[model samples]
Structures are given as C-alpha cells and as structure tokens.
Target: MQSCSSALCVLILLITTVTTSSGSASLSVTVKLNDSATLPCSERCSGLVTWTVSHKPTDVLAECDQTSCRSVKEGYQMIHDQYLKGNLSLTITDADFTKRDWYTCTCNNKDICDVALQLEPLRSSVQMKPGETLVLDLDVSDPVEVIYNSRANGSSGHICIVDRGSLECTVEYAQRASLTSALELKGVTPSDSGVYTIQVTRTEEVIHVYTVTIQDDLPHPDRDQETVVPVWGIILLILLVVLMGGCFCNVVVLQRRRNIMQRWRKTDGQRKKEKKKEKWLSLT
Candidate 1:
C-alpha cells in the first residue's frame, strides 16, 4: 500500500508539470497601438477567468469579465475584449502617449496567476550615404511587414511595397536628394538633397521609418576621373579624332597641288636648260 501511494503521488506531480508545459495555464501579452493587446488565456480550466492589469506592485488598473475587461487607467481607456475560444485579448481605446508603462496580465478562476506585458517600439532610425543604396535592418517579429516612403527636399514622398522578410532597400537617383523608400525618384537632382524618410508598417499600425539623404556630388569617384562615362562616348571621341585627321590630310594635298602649278608657270624646261648652261660656262 505504501509503494502504491508513492507511485500515485509521483504520477500526480508529473501530470501537473505536463499541464503547465502544454498550454494549460499560459499567458502572453503584446501591447501595441493606443490600447490594443493580446492575452493568451488558460486553455485547461474552462470557466469564467478574470483578467486584471497592474502597473506595479501597488498600481492596479482593471479587472476582467467573463471574456476580458476594458477600463480607464490614468488617461488610457480599454476598448473591447476579444474573448475568443481561448484568447483573452484587450483593445484599449484612446491610447495616451504619456501612458507608456508596464502592465501586468493576471488571470484568476480560483488561483490567480500573472504574466508580464511588453510593448514593442514602432520607431526606427537608419543612416544612408548620398547616392548610396539603402539597406533596412528590421526588428525580428513574425508576420511583420514594413512600408517605405521616399521624399526629396520638402516635396511629397512615395510609397512602396516591401517583403516582410527582406531587410534591405536599394534605389538609384541621378542627383543628390533626400528620398523616401515609400517614394522613388528617377533623377535625384542636387535640389533633392535633404532627409529621406521611410515609414515601416505592419498591418495597419506604422511600425518604423528610415531617413537618408542624397547629395549632388558624386560620392567616391576614381582619383583621376569623374562619373564613369559610357563606352560609346569614348568611341565617339575616337571617331571625331579620325575625321579631323582626314580633313587635315585633304588640306595638305590641296596646298601641294597649288605649289606645283606655280613652279611650272614660273619656268619651262627650255628656260631651265639655258640657266644650267650659263652656270657651267661661268665655272669654266
């Protein structure tokens, strides 16, 4: 009998551990937007479990209903409860910027347990060189998508679609300008120089934005060269040199013809022979 009781106690302990590990009474909360959060409620105990929010050991904000609870704490108001089959999520309506604080999620049927709620920041910063490519390094999260907006100077920017998993943005602009990834400019001129802002969004909430500037000056050129000219330009230059040489050769040929004609008119073959005989007699 003693052995049987000991075995039964061990079995009960194992069962409790398995229940806790296998999503029996687990809770996860994600705070985003003004007053929106998702709370994973207990799946084992099927009954009305109350959810509560506490800022610290002392500041308690709300209590849950059969589904979930929404209430006003300080200035922020909880909007609705998405009490699905197992989820006890709360959407806080009219989220206040000043109410950025820690909130604890507690669930109670008979025994009360709490889980920590955390908020993910939506603001992002990026550095880009003028005329250089823009590569975005995104924060790690699932099903998170980012939207890009590009602008130059003080003008309006453009929006673009980005892969949720791809964390890079590359665009070429002719002139220096601040462009938004959300906005793409073909010829970024010097006047386009300024801040380029890229706003990243996941679902409907704006998650992050990256800002970069394009300059009018070519960034890093070869020491002895400006921007790289196309091969066709070099070929054209060679053709122009060849044409100029041909024109010079034609002018030289015309000048030689004129000299020969003048020499022939100045003296005939008979005059040339007479002059030669006079020179020979003087020598004798």
Candidate 2:
C-alpha cells in the first residue's frame, strides 16, 4: 500500500514538473538584415519580469517592474506601458545575424514566454561577362561554406570555406579566388556560371543563395584596338595617292613641251639648208 502511494506521488510530481518547466511559445519572428524585431510575451507581471538568453539563463537581457523597464544590453528594450498590461515584448533595434537565438521571458522567476528569433534567408541574382571578377558578400562573421551548383551538368561541390577569418578554396579555384568579408573570383569564365550558396559550416543552415550567370567571352580590348583602322591613317593614305597622281601629270606635261621644241628646231634647220642650196644654184 505504501509503495502504491509513493508511485502515485511520483507521477503527480512528474506531471507538475512538465507543465511548469515549459514556457508557452508566444512568438516566432523572422526579420531581414538590419530590421527591427519584436519578441512577444503576453503575460501579466505583478512583480519583476525578466528576459534572458534561453541557454544562458543567468544573463538577463531585459527586465521590467511596475514603475519602469530597462534593457541590460544595447539594441534591446522592453516598453513600460506594455508591461503594465499583459504584454512583455522585447524589441531589438537593428537586428542582424549575430542576434539570432532562442530567448525566454520570466515573470517572478516563472517561465512565461519562449521565443525563437531568426533572420530571413537572402537570395539574389548576378550577371557577369567572362574574364570579369565576380564578387559575393559573405554577410556573416561566423564560419561558413560557399557551395557551387552547376546549371550545365547539374553537379554540385563546395568552392571554399571561411573559418576564423581564414579562407580556403578547392584546387580548381585556389589561384583565382580570394576572400575578405566577400568572396571574389578573378577572370571568371562561362564554366563558372552556377548557383552559389553560403551556409553555416557547423549547422549546414543556408544563409544566402546566389544565381550567377557568366555570359560568353568578350573580345579583348587590346586586340580590338589592334584590328581597328585609325581615321588619321586612312586620311594619310588618301593624300599619298593624290601626290603620286600629281607627279605623273607633271611628267607628262614636261615630255610634251620637250617634243614641241625639238620639232620646231628641226624644221628651222631644214628651211635654212634649202635657202643655201637655192642661192648656190642661182649663182651657177
């Protein structure tokens, strides 16, 4: 009979522990980068109400009493009027990647609200010509991996990893890639066209995905300049042809003048010789 009574008491204690230990999931918030976020807790607080990191219970983030409210850290606050009523929402100004975590609210040391805060996943597209540099923002200080998914062959692989401010890429990208808060690929080619994903290395949670399209190779600027004929060069060639034509015309005119002079001299000599012969015949 005593054993049965003890068992009943134990079961009752377990039921009570389960019910009181869990705070009601009052809110789930997802905000964009640098956006404001409100973690809500709808519970009346007659005494001191405190908000803290769920994992770090002793570190209070915000607290409110009947008279006023205070935020223990920057970028976080609890309103006075809301606490007087039934709302204990903590607002984070300029929410970012570093602020994503689970938070808990307590009123008089009893759990009242549990909130899960997260940032919206980033997605964007980019178009790049071959031989141009492709830059992608890492957007996070924590360690992460950049993955490539080829659109041509439907293959996928990791391009690089950023950890502890160091970046390491695969053998294919080692020579042409660099990372300093952003990933840069120099002299990109059509073969580099694909999707890039930035994910948390530890959790494999995707933070951002980029669709990159590398267009066909462009003509080299130096080569194009070499092939193009300059306007000044064409003008000089035209002038040379004109000068040669003028020289030919002058030579023809000089030859005609010389021929006329020679013909006149020969005719005068013939007339003179005839006169002399006539005189000699008259004398005879």
Candidate 3:
C-alpha cells in the first residue's frame, strides 16, 4: 500500500507538470508596420498544424499538413519546405495594425503555442508656436484611448477614450478638441509640448505616438521700419525725377528764346543794309 500511494503521487505530479508547461508556453513579439512577423513554432509534429487569432478562435488563419501548406487568410503563410523539419512558424507579410493580436498555433487539435503580436506604434513629430493648435491623426479602425505626457510640465494622463460609435474626451483641452477625423488641441503653450501616445485597448497596443515641441512666440522685428524705408525711397526717387524734368524743360525754353532773339537781330540788320544801299543808288 505504501508503494502504490507513492506511485499515484508521482503520476499526479507528472500530469501537473504537463498541464503547467502547456499553459505557460507563449511568445510575445513586436513588429513594425508594413514589416513581416515570424511566429515561431518549433514543434516537429506531423499532425495538422493550424493558426488562429485568439480573439476569434473560430476563424482559421492558416492550416498545413505533411502534404501541402495553404493560407486560409490573406497575408499568412507557412514555409512548406521547413514543415518537414518541424518548423511550423508562420510568416505574416506586410503586417499592419489590424493584425496586432494574440495568435494561437495548434497541432492535431491541441494547442501547441500562443504568439502575441504587438505592432510598434506609428510615430510623428510636430513643432508649433505658442497659442497655435496641434492635431493628431490616427489610422486605427477600432476604438482607442489617447494619452498625453508633457515633458515641460511633467504631467501625464489620459486625454480621451473613443468607442466604436461614440467619442468622449475627459480633459479640458481635449473637450474642445475635434472628433470629426482627428484629435485637435487648441491654444497650445510651451508647457503643452510633449509626447502623446494613442493606444488601442482592443489589442492592448499603442497604435500611434507623437512627439511635439512648442516654441515661444518670439517678437519679430518691426517690419514698419523696413516698410517705411522702401516707401520713402520710392517717393524721393519720384521727386528727383520731377525736378530733373523741370530743369530740362526750363533749359529747352531758354535755348528756344535765345535762338528767336538772334534771328530777330539778323533780320533788323539786313533791313538796315538794304535801306542804306537804296539811299546810295538814289544819290548816284
């Protein structure tokens, strides 16, 4: 009876170990947008291998066996040549935010592994002046939560939460923000400049991240002085042209008068000479 009890305890321990190992087998991987993600499954099982999204387990993504491998969903594939060697890993081409989720791989109707695919959030940088408005554009299809972290003020918190059909903003600044297409923050000051993170709660992943820098409204040089100088220069140029034209007209008039005076004097002299010749002929 002592030996039998000991055997039963060992059997129970073995079953517990197997259950623990199966439950604890999981992987987390991060991939960038439009890049490829490889879900590793190193099990060398000849049974039917299937991959499915954990959220929707009924939807089969892909399935493979010893004979051939095929994709049940677009953009998902398994390397057929590697299947014989027991590498049942799946390669998803052009990964996007829609593909970010928990993936489960099964062999012969048994869960072999779980892969959590986390996509790196899209990043954008913006610079704006004080009192200007900033906009954040997100490309997620599902609902999301927006978080704001200000480096200048050392403040960090949630700005809003968007549901499938409703949009609600919690912060005062975001309350005035637009919800038509993007998040808009108005009257931004230098203290408002910092990183803004947008997370999708459905996938529990950040989908968009933005780094913003706000600058002081620097006092620009008075353009009135610069503008006045050009106006005065143009006015002075017009006055100088008028003065030169007047002087040229006066000189031309004087030259014409002098010529008229010379012609009158020559005509008088000619008349006097003709009269003197007439008197000399009469006397002869």
Q: Per-residue lDDT of 1-284 in model 1, one digit per residue for the tens?
A: 99999999999999989877644344445566465544444332234444444435344454445554445354323323344344543344444333433344444434334454444555544333344445443333333343334363254444333454333333433232232433234443344344333333443434444554555443455633777777999999999999999999999999999999888877787698999999999999
User: In candidate 1, which residue ranges exceed 4 Å CA deviation?
Assistant: 1-24, 38-57, 64-89, 94-116, 119-284
* Segments in model 2 whose C-alpha atoms lie over 4 Å from true places: 1-27, 55-59, 217-284
In order of listing, the candidates' clash counts read: 20, 0, 0
Give residue 1's lDDT in candidate 2 (0 to 100).
100
TM-score list, all predictions? 0.30, 0.66, 0.68
RMSD of 3: 8.3
> lDDT of each prediction vs. the true structure?
0.48, 0.89, 0.84
- Quick one: ranking by TM-score, best first? 3, 2, 1
Residue pairs whose backbone atoms clash in candidate 2: none
| Highest lDDT model number | 2
**lDDT winner between candidates 1 and 3:** 3
Query: What's the true lDDT of residue 2 in model 1?
Result: 100
After TM-score superposition, what is the CA distance of residue 128 in candidate 1 from its true location, in Å?
A: 7.2
Candidate 1 vs candidate 3: the TM-score winner is 3
119-207 per-residue lDDT for model 2 (tens digits) = 88799998877879988888877799999999889999998999987889999999999976688989988888889999989878688
The best-first sequence of candidates by lDDT reads 2, 3, 1
Q: After superposition, how far is residue 123 of candidate 1 from its true place, in Å?
A: 5.3
